[model samples]
Target: MARIKPQALLNQSKKKKGPSRISISTIVVCNLVVAVVVLSLVTTYRHWSQRSRNTLETQSQSHRFEDTNAASEQKSYDLPGYADINTSKGLITVELFKDASPEAVDRFLDLCQKDHFKGMPFHRVIKNYLVQAGHSQSSIPVEEWTSKGKLRGRLNTSPKHEAFMLGTPKTKGNNNKDFELLITTAPIPDLNDQLIVFGRVLKGEDVVQEIEEVDTDEHYQPKSQIGIISVILKREL
Candidate 1:
């Protein structure tokens, strides 16, 4: 056979087949699939991790509160009961935490059952912050003590004073004042150590908000009369 020229060989090599468009397309699709899988896995992991963290935080706050008077338990317990507070503005329902603070809950229930809180003014009204009642005196007069329920021994205080939580300010001594009630409209971490949290608002959040919006004077007393008309204790959820 006759020898081929170098230029001719080069031209033949140039004419050879390259990779097909279908193969390149296949490679691109595979890469996209792998990328999508990795992204999905990362997103799922992050979402689950966030949920776990939130649950742990909530448990820690609600269950792990250690107090000088009470011992905090990591385990769970059943809630006590519920109540309806009939205020001048509207009806407010609350969930009792007898297991958490028995003395406070019992005292509160006793007072409500006896209609002791009837016509007692919300003495301290801090707009958008808190609403306090059951003080020694107010524009509206409170009845005599029907039950002298005072806190004794291990007082299981709340870890946090979350919004809508019903609690009492600490007294001069180690125990909380019997009738110095407080209902927070916003998170009050500062009062966490100063109050004994025993219940939370179940319904009547609108009433709570309305109470928070009530006009107050220089001393935090409401301009218009806002008081607890009555309170009814029930065993409902």
Candidate 2:
């Protein structure tokens, strides 16, 4: 049991406490550094995420606006230059030769727009010749069409011959006053100058053939009723 010096013992205790303090200080500094690094990383991630979300939202809004504008433009566009004749059999679309016969086209379009052709039967249908319609006397009996003197009065007795030529001005004699529309089933060169050829059948030629095949009397009047339901006129943009 040797006795230790007091100063030595005090020095030893001081050395032990110094190492403990150094260790504690080092641990506290390391923890602070780690906390600061973690906080910086979290802030950077939050900022990047916010920016990415905003960019996505902007892109989505731009696409929606473009689609809406395109749809609006499409809705505003007008139909192509054509007339739709909806008949009992099917729809017949005709493309008018505006350059060839402007007046005839105008008169026909006027009748169509006024709904004058609706419910009017194809009064005269001649197989391999022509199909005649637009007669106001459609509801009347076949004999009355000519016997009542209505047909005699409505005849274009002296139609303008110049009307057959392209770019010819419309004359009072060549106007469609009787509202008679003739669709030639075959190439009848003799009728070229007599009847107003404003439009040609673009679609539904089969329907024309069907109408021509219908049973008819000696007066060329359709035995079975065949009428136009409606007419839709469309102008090209």
Best by TM-score: 1
Per-residue lDDT, model 1, residue 214, is 82
Q: How accurate is candidate 2 locally (lDDT)?
A: 0.66
Task: Give each prediction's root-mean-square deviation over alpha carbons.
Answer: 19.6, 14.2
> On residues 1-237, what C-alpha lDDT tens digit does candidate 2 reach at each position?
998999999999998888543588888999999999999999999999999999999998998899898886554334235777788988877777665666666666667778878887888876766677765433334443234343433544332222112111123464344666566665544433345566777788888888889999998889999988998887741
Best by lDDT: 1
Report RMSD for candidate 1. Answer: 19.6
**Ten-residue region with minimum lDDT total, candidate 2:** 161-170
Q: Give residue 137's error in model 1 in angstroms.
A: 5.9
